[model samples]
Target chain A: MGYPRLSIAEIREGLRRKQFSCVEITQQHLKRIEEADARLKAFLTVTPESARARAAVLDQALAAGEPLLPLTGVPIAIKDNICTQGVRTTCGSRILSNYVAPYSATAVERLEAAGAVIVGKTNCDEFGMGSSTENSAFGPSRNPFDLERVPGGSSGGSAVAVAAGEAVGAFGSDTGGSVRTPAAFCGVYGLKPTYGRVSRYGLVAYSSSLDTIGPLARSVADLAELLQVIAGHDPRDMTSHGSAPDRYTSGLDAALRNHRVGVPFSLIEEGVEAETRRAIHRALDALERAGCAVEEIALPHLANAIDTYYLIAPCEASSNLARYDGVKYGYRSEHFSNLGEMYQITRAGGFGAEVRRRIMLGTFALSSGYYDAYFLKASKVRTLLIQDFQAAFARVNTILIPTAPTPAFKIGEKTSDPLAMYLTDVFTVPANLVGIPALSVPAGYTPDNLPVAVQLLANQFHEKALLHVAWHLEQAFALKPAALAV
Target chain B: MAITLEEVRHIARLANLQFSEEELQAFIVQFSKILEHIEQLSQVDTQGVEPTYHAVAGKIDRENARSDVIHASFLQEKALMNAPESEEGQFRVPKVIR
Candidate 1:
């Protein structure tokens, strides 16, 4: 029988109807991962035995007519940066390559409680520091849309797993554009919820101030469902909010009628690809057809996102990553004769090139001579970026932009050019800088058959509005893939 | 433009990292280019704007619980398992102070 790319809702329906047992569904995903993941490199580790064991229990519960959870019997992938108790959470770095989590991340534990079976941990850029998965110690995750191109990073593996049908949906953490960029490149739906909306207790720190865990799936509804399961307050993380999570999936029913969607013309700069420009207009047209009022607006300081993000994220990264000084846990060298040698050997041997690069840059920026010029000034600009979003949101319910300037590019294409790769985040990084909710939905396809994604940015905790607009686009445009029979 | 060798060395020292000469040369170029792209933030006007350090806007409520016992079992377990040098369940390292 040919495999079909099922959504989380469809999988739930299938289990409820007894059309396919959870074990059978889990086995099918495992088989698909075994076949496709070798080429895509989507997973860092595949837990087939554990997945089958968990799915069987869910299958038995269904047979006994027990009450079912929303995501019961669904198979999902997790980014390696998230701690899974007793599972190797590498974060795609050699430093933590052998590190096993003693406790699960709050998000992962919640997903398991929802009866979602974890199929595997996906690959990412080392410490979630790069735009391409090529920075991984393992290897780059290839775009399923085009084998030679990247799937996007550092959530490339999670996005590719969903795009390639290795699983129904996946979890990815976004520091800047990690989830949305990869989802855009892979032709899937991805969301980065408002910071603190999802608990970050078990997430290995990337940039403490910016890191957020979210979902990647084939559609907006599935993304919302995943968000519902993982989002809530955790006492372990002081920054986690006490606000109750809204019924994010149910928000899909809210009408897009009379909703105001804003577009900033300044971000659609000279360097944006012509096809991307056309797709953005086409998405806006779909929104207008769905009764959204589209208006052009100016967010002048938005262009400073990449610059401000680089300074702030790394400065925090330098601080958050300081715990891995070869003394506590993770990588420690055997040849270290002195305490200084131990610190140097462990960091140099364990960290990948990109991780080291960010650490060095962060150290420089926070140094005495450069602190006022780089770190302080960047913080001030970060404030301006947030203010720009606030001003735009006052008039518009949500802001729309292309998730990426272009579709997936060839692997190893931008790995050698760091500046060029950083620009890949130009459109999406502004949301991270501002700490708002953003979702990437499939907008259209390029002439070469690659996918383009349109990102919707909503004000703080306005994920409901963003997902509603995305759902309208999904239904009106029929963005989900129609034929995945293979 | 590439970062200079001296700059890379200075950054390494500031970060408390030791690097080989070959690694320093390669990093100088890569770090310089990445920093250049990040410099674009200098163009924005940010007068009197407050930096958002945390997204959770509310003040934390601490009326719930208090703990006098701090569990050191996990730390002790890890120290026992991986400590290169240890004595009486505590990690031992060469003396840094004179």
Candidate 2:
């Protein structure tokens, strides 16, 4: 299990220098997954035969001395919620436990076309609903740093996969901090690109407006490379934009020249753990040393984001998930006497408690008289929250905040209180609400040896500048999640 | 503004989900807390602001539909691959009337 941890950059460089064949690299990663995944429970399905088959083709191409594609021979994991043709994609839900997608998602197709080796499908909270993977029907994915602690969800497994060196890079979807929270908890890099920056063609929709597939990796360069390959418009996803992706890797080493960073002073001043506060300062100090300007800014409507999101996300999710009736695909209950009873019992037996709770909350929110008071009011607040980001970004290139209020907590810490669990995503929700791009970079480890992170966000489609500043800040902090020794 | 158990049952019927008595009791307690949390949204002055139904509200052109052109899609077999019960390329479900 002591395999060398190589970033996508290092893999390309090594492959070019004839250090090892594509099969060797893929096997090394497979070996790591085999050795560490038992404890981490990161992957729901490990496709060894297909992975080896894919690697063998790359090996043949390498023997033919072919030019390197952008992501040649790089091993990557996909979140189970994103469809993979002919692979069992459970979405960590019992409802779709046996479902095999007939076609791949646009992002998965793009990654494979770029010569990436598909390693496996990783676990997630059922249908990407919960902030912690405890809602996963298959069971929660454990944090690689500490087995007793929870890995942030619903992309927890993808984060653990990259953190444990099971894969070179991974793709996870972020609706409300699904990607960034897990990355922060696991001490890695995860980027949630601007809404419509990546297509959602074959993705199983949770909250369509907020859901976007993103990459998690051990390095910013790998994160950028993954983003570059998967970004751009698709005819299948009408919301996806048509702009060409920028050369994401071209500015990884660029200096943070004239970059003004804004922090919502009062937001972080309250309720955040002291150690987490110190970690944010550590990242800001490093950025300041590298010539970044840090200033306090106001985001008056920010505190209402969590409540606004809970209402809006569940509302959208209820509509999107209406297709899971017993007549269609997925699980069907055996206890029903009639068609209507079948629909009710199928959903009751098929969905977990949290999923049903959200659906109930959403249905109530949209019911006859409640729609105006609940959904409408929440949507107006959403507008106000969006305006808050618009006002904040006017004064700075990017906003900085702690990725989470604290490090990874014990497994059962917040599961008992869904409201308590939802509050953990307090700082990460505004970006999703405004449809902006946000990146979570590991700031440092806590005294308890858990990792904490600082988040950076840019206005819509400004990933290039955001990533440039992130790369600078990454260097200023200069730490590796591979130090996890999984 | 507390949620009654009867309303909880009504919402479950609307959502087409079934819950045991025990689960409903827990839902009443937990969901009321969540409802209380979101009640603060009404206190914010959103009088003149338009509700944002979609994050990218006007950015997408939803008025016009894609052209009525035939294209490749999942075949009946592939589409029904995951159905629990199917016959003659159609998903089978319990009879609506008996």
Candidate 3:
């Protein structure tokens, strides 16, 4: 093996045996980051000094014979949207480019507490607004599968780092398919946990109601381990659920025999490529052989998911992102003489095109005359969409669909066409809208050598069930660990 | 159903964002396309369904509000230092209505 592409388990085992110190492992990831990140643009900032210092202490603790957590010494990348203490948490916006968070996000705090060394902060869509990382003030992250194409986005950098072997695993927030879409495009495993299952405290809010922080890893087990560490309630966040029961990583090895999996017929949508269809079939066949009862079901309203998501997400985003008036912790205009001038100039200069567009849409939707016609109507539509999912889950234990309509598109393919860009999340958005847990695992690849993923959606608080299905598929469809040759 | 440039400008004003003429024209076209797509949701009949404002299933305990536990972290301290304008340890913004 080139450099021992260590999963979290393997790295933990290696650490236990003292095969490599935490500092050594961290340095290896840092070295890979330095060598690979320039071309990939996967990271916004690499905290080499902090990572080394943290890793050194873990190494010292090991020398003193102290027991370490399972994720100890494992270098992981964090999406820039998630706050890390004393580190710049930009949320991929010029607005907060210099904004350093004094306290870490609850998820980041939990992961670091479990001894996971945060290697760097990865790039993201500005304020997690775009489906593609192209909306970033930073450059778009290149797909590790094909450098010419985008590594799917919003959470593109997190997905790219894990796929490119820069980090064993990483954290990313999913709002409107940010995590799973990029994970699918980059050919990595990503999980969007049930809303309220993971604490959103310290994650710069982007649509508070729909946003979820989750993991992107090379394998299902690694994703599972990362999820276990980060999944819990936080007193700091009122929206966080306290009573949700989870033994997510435990007892998942029963092997998906005699389980029912529903394949949404709407997955074969108008724009789906022929190869993407065949890839889903191949994945289904593997599941069938493994004793899964694969059946074709119709979630008719799923076709409307993208529409409901656009209205509801932007509306929530309009409210959530209103806090960055430039009078707070971020960039402020020096030329503004009056307060209105300050707000106008600072936001205009700080925000990008997509951010501006969403803000406008959201404001319009929530405006006095339009509230009932737009935001309230969209809210009602969201309930219907959730009901559709709840009804579908009643018939099936898991819902199987394509993560993206097709595999990774060219970097600039849909940037000009906003609707085309929005349509990429057609399949992934419904899961987010319903606040159910979902996972994207590499199903197979196109003949053109790009990766396509099959997504599995489970009902609310059904993370364990969703992951069990993903892990089963991961083992069966263990396509020869291929990645772009560095 | 095409969104006009005037509508785009109106929305931009409500958002408190400044848009150039070119941006307004582009957004008029783009938002029109998005609105065209989004109009499909209205076709679905959603009578009697409870609108989901939040994702969580159960009711939050309004009776069980926790006391504010202050962390002496730099985040609180920096919130003050990072304020654009402050007076007597409070953030000062423009007066709401002139």
Highest DockQ: which candidate? 2
Q: What are the runs in model 2 whose C-alpha is more than 4 Å off?
A: A480-482, B61-68
- DockQ, all candidates in order: 0.48, 0.68, 0.57
- Lowest lDDT sum, 10 consecutive residues, model 2 chain A, at A477-486
The TM-score of candidate 3 is 0.96
* Quality of candidate 3 docking, DockQ: 0.57
lDDT tens digits by residue: candidate 3, A360-389: 888888888878767888888888877777
Q: How would you encode candidate 3's per-residue C-alpha lDDT over B25-87 as one tens digit per residue?
A: 777888888888887767778777678888665645643245667665554456676676788
> Candidate 3: which stretches are off by over 4 Å?
A1-4, A266-269, B59-76, B85-98
**Best candidate (score: lDDT):** 2
| Per-residue C-alpha lDDT of model 2 across residues A351-437, encoded as one tens digit per residue | 998888889888999999999999999989999988988888888999999889989989999888999999989988888888999
Best by TM-score: 2
Share of real interface contacts recovered by each model?
Answer: 0.48, 0.74, 0.61
- What root-mean-square deviation over C-alphas does model 2 reach? 1.5
For candidate 2, the per-residue lDDT at A347 reads 90
Could you arrange the candidates by DockQ from highest to lowest?
2, 3, 1
- Please provide, for model 1 over A28-104, each residue's C-alpha lDDT reduced to its tens digit, 9 standing for 90 to 100: 99999987788889999999989999999998888888988888889999999999987888999887887777778
